[model samples]
Target: MDMFRRTFAEVNLDHVAHNFEVLKAAFPNTSFLCPMVKANAYGHGDVAIALCLQQAGARHLGVCLIEEALLLRRGGVTANILVFRGFDREGAEQLLANNLTPVVSTWDQLEALEEMAKTPVKIHLKFNTGMNRLGFSIEEAEKLFDKCWRHPKIQVEGVLTHLFNGEDADELDGDSADQLGKLLRILLVFKPLNPLNHSLNSAGILNALIVREQKNPQHILNQVQWGLRPGLMVYGFNPLKRQDILPLKPVMTLKSVASTYRMLKVGEVVSYGGTWKAKRDSVVAIVPIGYADGYHRILSNKAEVLFNGYKVPVVGTICMDFLMVDVTDAIHGCDLNDLRDKEIILFGKSDQGQFISAEELAHRAQTITWEILTSVGERVPRVYVGDWAKRLGVAN
Candidate 1:
């Protein structure tokens, strides 16, 4: 069905490909680039993005659950999907049936694999260096090798870990470095098993590049083939904000049009709590999107959006299905009819050359870019665009 509302998100598949190319070029030593598509590809629509990346030559993809992996398999994605969340017996069976790989983090997960495997199954072993969230701790290395790695049904295809602070790779004694040191030590124990080694996410990938450029043969990171699982960077937001390293074009642009306008007199308040009272005559554009649509309520009267090539302040409490923008200056010379066809950009570049990034919105909301991107509401239709979209017959 076509979009029923003027509000939607435009996803550029070309930008996705460009970002992939940039990442590949930045990390030439990377054996594979596993694009994380969890949380609906951070709300950009997973199936479409996965298909785009697969067409772009991605051999591997990452998702948080077997259900997500199954979604991709059903969507015609043929890449090697690594399910981050460990599975139960039924999930393990499904993984085998779909040719999906599972990351074994806990012993119970290993037991599930052992219980479900009738044939040899490839798996990535997750070791906890410092994150303390998931994975087998480093102290459990010898026990894992002895108990699971040698299990006949379980084939150790890769060894992996999460770097708690990849942004600190510059400091030799920093948390990231210390974590890498531990990972490399684990690699030493698993080297004979011949598993792919990976620990870096987007920030870690950039750090890997930094360490690579140094060309120090003695660096702890040079121990094995580096497989990177880049999450945010692939979708075009930099974790460390280092665009100079690899310039990334944002894939998703959230946009909407003013549904109608309201003229407010001085001292007249707006929205749920009368939080924003106009100090003078104001022209407010009522946008057809709100907190329910993934626009955060904290952004009420705190964020700005691009309207008619100008920055307009968001006014009043953001409602469940609407938001109000003060566009007095933006509509100075244009008739209301003139803006009927214009778009108001919540984030990403506007055709008129003005831009508002997700990072900017995240700052306004006192959150991170990841939360901002993933929080985009499921109800907001994702309008796919660009070369891949055209080829895939999903272009808008």
Candidate 2:
């Protein structure tokens, strides 16, 4: 497939590999470093990102669906792929065929797995420790395991939970601690089984590290094989938006070119709704990207794009396929004719070493960095670059 549009997302694979190592160092006790590659690697091209991580020594990977695991398997991801979403009978059959692990949290899922397993199959038991979204309750898990009714073919490989308030350090000592305490009690039931235990996400990992430094480190983590599954941080964006956190690089740079240039007179209206009127003679650059491109419509007149290392306001209402930027001040950096072909950065690093972070862009759009990255529509081609690109046999 050929990408004809100038508007696209550039993914730096090296940054991803670097981030993987940094995250591993942060969670030193991680027996399994499972980076979530679901939602098409958060819309950053799953296959490429997965392969890069696998090469960077990721022995395990996490996804949200059976189909997502199958995609990675097809893409030559030989690592242990754990499907976070529990499976049914039909989904269980595929798991057996593909050698994929399912995170079981429901009786139906257990029944389905037991009925389908002719050979031994490994599964992770998910406990609901206040994150009511998924997983069985502590009492439910205790009763289920105590019954000793698990299929001989069904093997419990790990016990895991989600941290609902992992971003706040105080919550790590309170709510997250309560959650882990529940997970710890569950761990006792499976102690003889020796299953890996994990509960920290991106924010949880950072907050947990902070708690470890401020107090004695080896309480819940000392006795068991622990795992860390970081999603957003794997892509090099800070989930907590703290400057003191890991020094990770932004992997994807959303960019476009100034496709058309126009000189707007004072009082002249621009774009739909005419919400913005030129206060002075302004150099308007029509960037070929809009709401359909994952650039939020609400960012109509609030977002800024980088032009020649200068931040230019996105003036007027953003259209379905275009947005107008006032490049009058930016014109001082380059000639008007030169500006037409100049690369405009929506977010991430530019050729001139200037960088615009997705964190800032998401903030301006009244959203989060996760949404901003995944919201990038499939229409935008993902151009893979970095030292690992050629190693992955990928090209821009």
Candidate 3:
């Protein structure tokens, strides 16, 4: 079935590939570029996005769970895939059967592997530097290193940790730098193991590298083979908030159209709870999308859309599958005689060359970049476009 509809997401793989190339070039010493395709590649459709990154020269792909890995495998993605969330005994057996790497984070996972390992399993050890959510502590990791030191079935192929605030601006010995320093101290213990050294995510890649430079100005980032896993940036949002950092392009374009228009008299209420009333004789366009599509309800009166380059305010509480945009100021530029189907720019580049950015929408929603991207509801049909293969110099 064709999923394209009046409201949909356009995922430009060309933009994705470009971002991947830029990120890979930044870390030449990187053994491989592992673009995290978890959370459905941040709601851009994981299998399609992952395939694009692979063709764009990703050395490996990262996912959150075994189910995600299996989806890619079944979708014909044969690249080296790693499941970041460690699995149970059955999940570990499936991981082995599927030949996907598991991120062994906890002692329970290690014991599960021990009980289930019929063959040698190459695992990446996860250390909880400060996130304190997943993975073993530093002392527990020391014991884990010894446990896997020469295990018959467990092969510690790499070590990694998450940088909680790697994108924050404060540079001097802050949480991000301090946490990375702690991880490095532990990573040093496994230097002799020669695993694929990797710890930087999208936010961490540029900022953490800066931290490394500041902390060790004399020498390059150690002898271990470092790699990077660009997640959000891979989908084309700069966590550092500097567009020049990699000149990333916008990948996902959430869109819909003004299905119909209505005239609201002064004092007329709109949507639920009477939260909004037209103070003036206003023209409102029914935008056929709402919180159900991951457009936060908090963005009810706070958000705006693009119409003929004019900012049209969303004036009412967003409904489950519809909302209203006040286009009184912009209606003159559109076909006023036939106001319906005037074209609504939910978020992305507009015909007028202006962009209704996700960051702006996110700000209105009281959230961040990741939430905005990942929360783009699954019902919004994802249409992957662009010539990534040609751009990557690969045969189509």
User: Best candidate, lDDT-wise?
Assistant: 1
The sequence of per-residue lDDT tens digits that candidate 1 reaches over residues 200-263 is 8888787667767787766655555567999998889877755567788999899999989888
lDDT of 2 by residue, 116-228 (tens): 88888888989999989999889886676764336578788888998888776335357777788788898888777777888878887776665566665454433344568
Per-model CA lDDT versus the true structure:
0.87, 0.85, 0.80
Poorest lDDT segment (10 consecutive residues) of candidate 1: 217-226
Better of 1 and 3 by lDDT: 1
Sorted on lDDT, highest at the top, how do the candidates line up? Answer: 1, 2, 3
lDDT of 3 by residue, 79-132 (tens): 999999888888988998999988988888889888887988899999898888
Q: Which is the winner by TM-score between candidate 2 and candidate 3?
A: 2
**In model 1, what lDDT does residue 119 have?**
92
Q: Evaluate model 2: give its lDDT.
A: 0.85
Give the TM-score (vs. native) of candidate 1.
0.96
